[model samples]
Target: MLLERILRFFIVLIMAIVGGTLFELAVPTANAYFTAPLWHEEIAVLGLSPAGLLCILCGTALGGMIGYPLAPFVTGWLRRLSLWVEAQLGKMPTRDVIAGAMGLFIGLIIARLLGDAFFTIPIVGDYIPIVFSIVLGYLGVHIMVRKQQELAEVFDFIPRFFRDMPRVREARVAPQAPAAVRDGQTDRQYKLLDTSVIIDGRIADICETGFLEGTLLIPVFVLEELQHIADSADSLKRVRGRRGLDILQKIRKESRMKVEITEADFEEIAEVDSKLLQLAQEVGGKIITNDFNLNKVAQLRGVSVLNINALSNAVKPVAIPGDLMTVQIVRPGKEHGQGLAYLDDGTMIVVDGGYRCMNEVVSVEVTSALQTAAGRMIFAKLTR
Candidate 1:
């Protein structure tokens, strides 16, 4: 409401100024053509002709009246157009947006110069600048967006040029600290937390132990996903989602490490995993997740991934061949005469020829332990 009033005031003020100027310009012509005594008569109070003062007053009043009604419609239209532009920009990558803006500025400058050169041409002269500006501005944006990567490379020299400058004098006076060191301490790495790791709830525990260092970076998109899950119709999904949110809150409040929620998101990327990879690259951070597929994909993309499942497996007690251990077979395996059991930390132990021992604890000799991306599996046979 306040904004609308401000807009209305500006509109009225501008119209009144223009109207007064126009009336002032026209009054001389009127006085010249009419050649009346009334036109020539000056007012004693203000040193102006009575007709000129009256015409200016009427013009200002008319302009104010006209502007008053048009303000609301113009304001509403501008608000909607701004919203649309914001939405469109949000969908584009940051690099592309920057490049497009630069291109638009350059295009407009060129258009202005070219437009002025042809300003002397009759009839079409006035429209030429407008047409040129629209066409060039659009071409600039399109071309820059399509070639944003190449443009980024082109601009890469700016940083390199600065970096290559000699700092021998500064070094002699006072040596600069290394990038990794802050106040004589090593700088911690940024550990970006993914949804799966948050939901799994081990990250908070790990953080509490002070094993994990660096800032716990949580992206806004990951938080949104958690909220969506928390609001899910399914009870299990809702619980998991709520748990993730709770874990995040606890980590933020209790954890010693810096906790930051980044608004950085890749709208161009559809998959959350892909976005996570992109974000990792952007921030030079490692992703913390429990997702096997995500870990593999991230590794393939050369992005560092810290998988909770893999970490769990790494920390578990190593079970080698010929090691004797006792296990309870809770269920039969796919193979005949084989039973399956899980270690305390959820490691799968396949008990061969122990089908009859289902629902019972028995001694078993480990045959082998195979390690995979998901986890570790131990193969064993009944000792009895």
Candidate 2:
């Protein structure tokens, strides 16, 4: 509100000054062209003429009156324009915005140099410089924004300088405690949680086990996605989304570990996985998810990831060939005379020559174990 008033005052002041200047110019023109032949007597007593003085006073008063009323409207329009500009900028990635700004600066510098050269040309000279400036500015921005990632590497020296700088200390000062000791906690690491891990509900159990450390950071976009899914027309999607929200609520209430809902989001990235990667990069954090594709992408981008599925696989009981275990053959497998069974943890067991033992628990000898993208599968034969 205070800023608006200040802006209004400046606008009104400028408009009034312009109006007075116009009146001053008009009075001189009128005197030279229309007033000189009509008046013969002395129109001025002092240095100032009556006609000129009257025009000055009238113009100043009229300008002030007009500006006073129009200021609010002009101020509102400027405020709206500023808000629109900010909204547009917010839609672009931070890297792109920085690249675009640098490009624009370089473009203007080039335009100024070329404008001087073009000024000597005929007919088209007046307009050519402006057109060139606009075109070059746009092209520069487009190219720079597209190559923003590569351009970012050019500034590596900045961080390198700070990293190499030596610390200076006073000789007589008492030593301070380490930051962790002073804060009464270990150095906090952030782990950004994704929608898949949350909905899978294993994360909540993992938190209960007290193995996973660090603060769990959930982005607002992920929550919004969950909400959208919860309100979906498909019953299965709605149920899964509701379960995810429930799991989140349970984690918040039951777990002693820190869980935070973050408002940080990248509007420029359309996909949630891409935004998660960007967020992890910005926060210097690891992403905790069960999404295989996300895990691969994060790994390729050099971002740290904690895959729940991977953790589960790593901790599953190791079964070797020739080891005997009991499994219930629930159904038949694709191979002839094969039976499929499942362990308590949902590991698939393919039993050979056990098709007749369907719906029965029997001892099986492990033949081999294979790990796939989905999970681990064990091939076994019924023990005699």
Candidate 3:
């Protein structure tokens, strides 16, 4: 609102200036066309010559009056148009936008050199340069944006060059103590928590165990997402969202690990997962998540990710083939005559031929164990 008012004030000032200039021009034109016929003799008006002070006073007053009423609407329209353009630009990925700008600059440089060669042609020569510049600039931006990833690879040499540069020798000075040593060992790796890991609620327990180190960085946008979910009309979603918030509070109050909520945001990225990935890259930190798809995406983007599910799978008690264990068949599995049970660590155990023993404890012989993206599944047969 303050910005809008400031813009309106400037718009009014500019309009008043323009209106004054127009009126000043109109007075002289009117005198040349109509003043001689309308007045028999030159008369002093407003205590000065009619064409002098009177004209100036009337033009200035009329201009200010006309400009005062129109500024608000014009400034409001301009503000809205600027906001719309900014939103459109924000939707584009940062890398693509940078690549396109670089390409456009290079294209214009080439076009200017080519245009100079065509300067001697004729009337067509005058327009050919402009047409070439427009066409080449468009093509350059389009192609560069499309191939932005490959261009990134090509530019890897820039960093390599700086790394290879020789350093100048100087008198040695004592190194200052590291920030971690001075801060009571509180400085640790920043582990950015994702919404999935938060909702899973195991992170709070892990933090309590002191197995996890470093400050847990929670972005404000992630909290907003949890709030959105907590307010959802769906009961399951609301429960999960509230559970995530509860886990966050528990970690902050009870856990030994340092927890920090960050307000950093990427206005350009709409997806929370993408924003998280970008944040991880910016902070040179690891992403903590249980989302399989997000894990894959982060890995593809060369960002470090610590998947809670993977960690759980790695630490769960190993169930080898032919091992005998007792489990209660709580439900039937997708396959016929197969019953499903869960181990203490939540590993799925498919008990063969135990469907008839539902809700009953039975000794089962493990047949095989399969590790998948979701988690580990153990297949077993009911012991005879």
RMSD of each: 18.6, 20.6, 19.6
lDDT of each: 0.82, 0.81, 0.80
Cα shift from native, residue 182, model 1 (Å): 17
Q: Better model by lDDT, 2 or 3?
A: 2
Q: Please, what are the lDDT tens digits per residue for candidate 3 over residues 1-384?
A: 888778777766776677667666666532333344335233432233456545666666776677678777887789889999789789875566788898899889889899999978988889888988999899889988877656755787688566534321211121122223223343368899999899999998898898988888888889999999999999999999999999998787567887767767788899999999987776667999989899889999999999888888899898889899999999999988989999987899998898999999999999999988778999999887
Error of 2 at 269 (Å): 1.9
Name the top lDDT candidate. Answer: 1
> Which candidate has the highest TM-score of all?
2
Per-model TM-score on C-alpha atoms: 0.49, 0.51, 0.50
TM-score for candidate 2, please give it.
0.51
Clash list (residue pairs), candidate 2: none
- Scanning candidate 2 in windows of ten residues, the lowest lDDT window is 170-179
Evaluated against the true structure, the overall lDDT of model 3 is 0.80
Off by over 4 Å in 1: 1-188
For candidate 2, lDDT tens digit of each residue in 119-214?
A: 889998888889879988888888787766556556766784575343224212312322222234434677888898889999988997889888
Candidate 2: global Cα-lDDT? 0.81
